[model samples]
Target chain A: MKNKTNTKKGLVKAAFMSFIVVLFLTTTNCSSDGTQIVANFTEIVMQDEFNTEGAPNNALWTYDVGTGDNGWGNNELQYYTDRTENVKVENGYLLITANEEEYNGSSYTSSRLLTNGLFDQQYGRFEARIRLPYGQGMWPAFWLLGENCDEVIWPQCGEIDIMEYRGQEPTKVHGSVHGPGYSGGEAITKTYTLENDRFDTGFHVFGIEWTPDYINYYVDDKLYNQITPADVTGEWVFNQPFYIIINLAVGGSFVGSPNAETVFPQTMLIDYVRVYKN
Target chain B: MKNSKNLYLKKISVVMAILLTTVISCERELSEDAVFAEFGSNAEIYTDAPVGLTDQFFTSFDPNQGANTQGFGTDNNEAYLGSSSIRIDVPQPNDPDGGFIGGIFLDRGQGRNLTGYDALTFWAKGSTTAIIEAGFGTDFSEDKFVVGTKNVVLSTDWRKIIIPIPDESKLIQEKGMFLFSAGTQSTGGVGYTFWMDELKFEKLGTIAQPRPSIFNGEDVVQTAFLGAPVPVTGLTETFNLGSGVNQTVNVAPSYFTFKSSDTNIALVSERGVVTIVGIGSAVITASINGVPAEGSLTVNSGGNFDLAPTPTRDPGTVISIYSDHYTNVPVDFYNGFWEPFQTTESADFIANGDNILGYTNFNFVGNQFANPTVDATVKSNLHLNMYIPDNIPANLDFLISVVDFGADGVDGGTDDLRQQIFFNSSDFVADEWSTLEIPLTLANRSHIGLIIYENVNGSPLTDFYLDNIYFYE
Candidate 1:
């Protein structure tokens, strides 16, 4: 009878251990599907689902060109091509690569896509999942600009950069705001990093919660920076409508020109974009 | 039982001690202001008195004066005043856009007319970097005033500041008093400490006007007429006035051959006007060998020439380089030359009728010198200038004065002044008008050169039009 009791007790212990293991794996693996719902977002176009085909129906995109340097602060060098080679769907992902070649006086090329004509929102939660490229000079930015460009030019139009990673500092990402009282060289920025290896290893979600009184920037779910509109003397740049933009700039005054150490054909893999209005 | 009783006594004593300390500390913090007033026996305290007996000087920053209150727990301190007897405030305003923004200001009813005043002055104590800005308007916008900024180090001391009122011919009709201030929006929109007192306004003196009409009567003729690009030539063409009614085709040479050897001055054509972009004298000889007539042209260092006809002016107004009664020349050699003359500093204007020349000439010049260094409230530091075309004679000397004729307060009036120089044949050629870009560089006080004809001494009767003038950048 004592031997039978021992067996029963041992079996009970084994079952408890198995239950703990299952619980651990289930919790850890489940979070990877982006079910972690970082901050609620108002609008987002996940580029991951379009890996098989470019964003279905070209849902969120606007082409920009012709105006030259005067177009978009006159800092970029591409004609913003829609050609698949410039931007393409491959391996179940939208790949944006920077190329070094001659095109209409400006050398080096890239693609810039915007949700300007497609969607615009005043305030809510905004988040994007992106994997950045690494090298010496690549500048990949996932940001937003005011949609009122005809009435007000850039900077004055307001810009909120959710994730701006310059390859020079491979492991860090910057979130910033550019507007009237503070823009161009006067932009405000803050940097963040992942818990483990640099962000290039895989996709990471970047986000921001934009409300009337405060703007909270986030990495995954970690809040990093907050700015109130009243903190500045200039008009509130965030009060109006704004749309999203994603691009990889080659060389610019702010982000030093790409160097030989930099590698080309780097891809920013976006898992998904989702928005929730509050 | 005895041990337990001892423990209870110990706990009660400890509680009583804690209660006593908290009560004492709170009372002391609350009574700080009372102690501060009496703590320093050696410290001197001055009573608040209205400055500028005419209520021109009111201390709005001092709580003791009863004119205003210091928000955010701030109190009046005598140390905030300046040695000049201007009241001062060292406010500790806390919240952004919520704190007590303090300053001693002068009131000129609605606005003060500084019609006759020659200069402005005040005293200041710098707590961090401070500014002694005097605005001349009851309202913040559309007023012209001067801000004398001083970067002061923190100290338990005092210093005086004096600002020279530049171009008093325009500022005196100031209908406002001085402003001794701290906590401007520039200080991170936060609080700063500045002490001022003994506000005094003394007329330093008037600005003397320079003599005008320095043009030496030599006519400058454009050797090249307005036309298409051509091969190099040795002689230039001249125009002929038809003498009789039938002399319609009394044609003259339509082109001139310029000697390549005299290429010291590079001449470019915009429409038909010939611009000399060189420093040395180039002989642009246009010789009509048959009649044997000759004219000489000299180019000066860093200068431009205008061949257009002057604007029609009021017949009686003295027509010289500094005449306000006339308009600017029809053309602006520099963009935005009309900015300085307009009543409104806003860069607003309608693009008007097309000029005989293709370029669009707005009735008003666009904005120049985006940020100015003077007062933005009382009087605009607008030294208005108009371009005038004068007929060149052998040699003539003229007088130029900077004068103003306006109301002492808000009533509008005229204030004018002229800077004089001499022009000789060696300086500028005649028949063609000379355009002098004023306030030469982006500087507050720039060089104003006049051709003071050292030889001739009378103003000529020939009419010249002045148009499109401004403070050049």
Candidate 2:
């Protein structure tokens, strides 16, 4: 199956920002003319460079041990595991691998690392430098879930997907948000695509700068999307704190089933994850 | 010996430099400026007309093969891109001069440097939907890098076709612009128009994942003899295109960098020819652009080959089918692959000038010689040599059937007669040649057209060798 990467149709560049506003901010764009100052997030809150070569920093990260009922309600095929075979930190990167094999009762195994009660935040600049895997049925995502998820029903707690990629389209990634009436397929989302390049081939930065009023998406510091309270169909649940979640999920309803040609042992490598206070 | 040492040292240094990164993903290095001076780098072979090529474009196949030379030219009425397109009119089988159309387009100049191009792209359509075979890398003289894709199905509507180069870096100075062959066999010997346009080599970054293979991607272990040229065969490259088509093309050995595990036992050439030199074993492997091919060859050398005894019968009393001694008659094909049932393949080869018929994955195979039926009325016995290259199976039951097209001398006719000769397990020996001279079981031998060999009775015979077939009294 050939999935052409989504184009940059909804691109909203930071070049339109006022010169005075840009002077007080910093941008990552190497191009002099197209300077990007999406947000002023200078105060560092939490950061994981994945520089260690062993189990993740225990004090900062935790794992979702086993496959839940119906793959945690997404009907994902992989049995979540904490083993080094599925998740490990090596060579300055966090490798979350999805392997095709029988594990527990599931035919696939992968990892879901989260900072639930460990490090939760309300609004900030959350970003991760990652090099993703490629193939059908592979879903690697970096997103945030409401910290009060146990006390509230899912959409009631809110979700902000900073970066979510369908493995078949190596050049494109989607940034989205799910709320009360905008959950699952009804979520507000926008795609950011790389031109003449692919995320699976090299390292790329995926991030989101969020405030009480709006959430701006950045792929390699080029702001491509923004979602606000007005953009949601229902209640704006952004006031609550949310925890970080980075997972490599196998076959699911969003990406359909894996074909015979899908290569096994797909890995989503994360160089670092850093959150900053604006 | 000289080349292996140099290669070994180079490999060690390369492994040190790359360290532990993924080679498959990092092998794609950007092409820099070539050292060669002022070379022709024209990527386009045809546009409104021939790009860098000369005025004389189309070269038809040999006249003796019934290639209709007059049926090919540029047609302005039909073009997929420019003002005209290349149109080849495939003729009927009974065309007086030529029956099939095929040939190559040569770079009349000192050849063009196509190092930057990744694939040969073209738009094609047929008068009716037809299958066309096309590729490049064959300059007709060296024919070194010939890569051909078979069964390129084209519909009436114009569709683009892409044939990826095995390794673009190898085409430093290439003369072979394009190669194509079209026949009317698919159309039941009738004629059809095949049009191709916008022909050129393109840097289509879409062709990715070059999966090259030897022995058709199967890890093959074969017994070899000293002084025998055990040439590696079945070289191909399978690529996953941007359009989701997995295209596999037969490639030349020049595209690979061959290596032998133990050079003392055997040595492999850049041409992918493996030479069995000693009594020990060696594994031959290859790689393209640092990516290792899928298959390998483990050759177990058995000193020198022990030749089968030469036939001594008088030539007048023999109706030879195949032999080094006798002049054989015209044979149609060595293996008629009866699909859906038969699994055997003719892995035939020549070692030290001796032709050997190798039936690999053997289950059932056939040889037909029906252009003119063989009249073996005078000869009453069939003589042939058989060698079990591998271990002889315990329940080996080999059967040979000789078919005679009775009245009309036509195959599959109602009056066709057949004869069966069987060989039990006791008649075979491992690694030794056995001569089978079976007496004729058929009453009529005047119109014999086909010889079929099959393994039956729960036999596990898969690979074996054959030579010196003749019918003699």
Q: Each predicted complex: what DockQ?
A: 0.03, 0.15
List per-model TM-scores for chain B: 0.27, 0.80
* Candidate 2 Cα outliers beyond 4 Å, as residue runs: A1-37, A40-43, B1-38, B54-56, B60-103, B124-132, B151-159, B181-195, B243-246, B327-344, B349-353, B363-373, B404-417, B441-444, B447-450, B456-460
DockQ class, candidate 1: incorrect
Worst 10 residues of 2 chain B by lDDT: B29-38
Native interface contacts kept by each candidate, as a fraction: 0.00, 0.00
Best by DockQ: 2
lDDT of 1 by residue, A50-130 (tens): 545753246666655432464346365444566665677666666777777776566666778778778888888777777
lDDT of 2 by residue, B200-235 (tens): 998866566578899898898989887666778889
Q: List model 2 lDDT by residue over A1-278, tens digit each.
A: 01111122122233444554665544434243443335678899999999889999988899987777787778888999989999999999999999999888889999999999899988889999998887788899999999998899888999999998887776779999999999999999999877646677678999988888889899996888878889899999998788999999988888767788787888999999999996
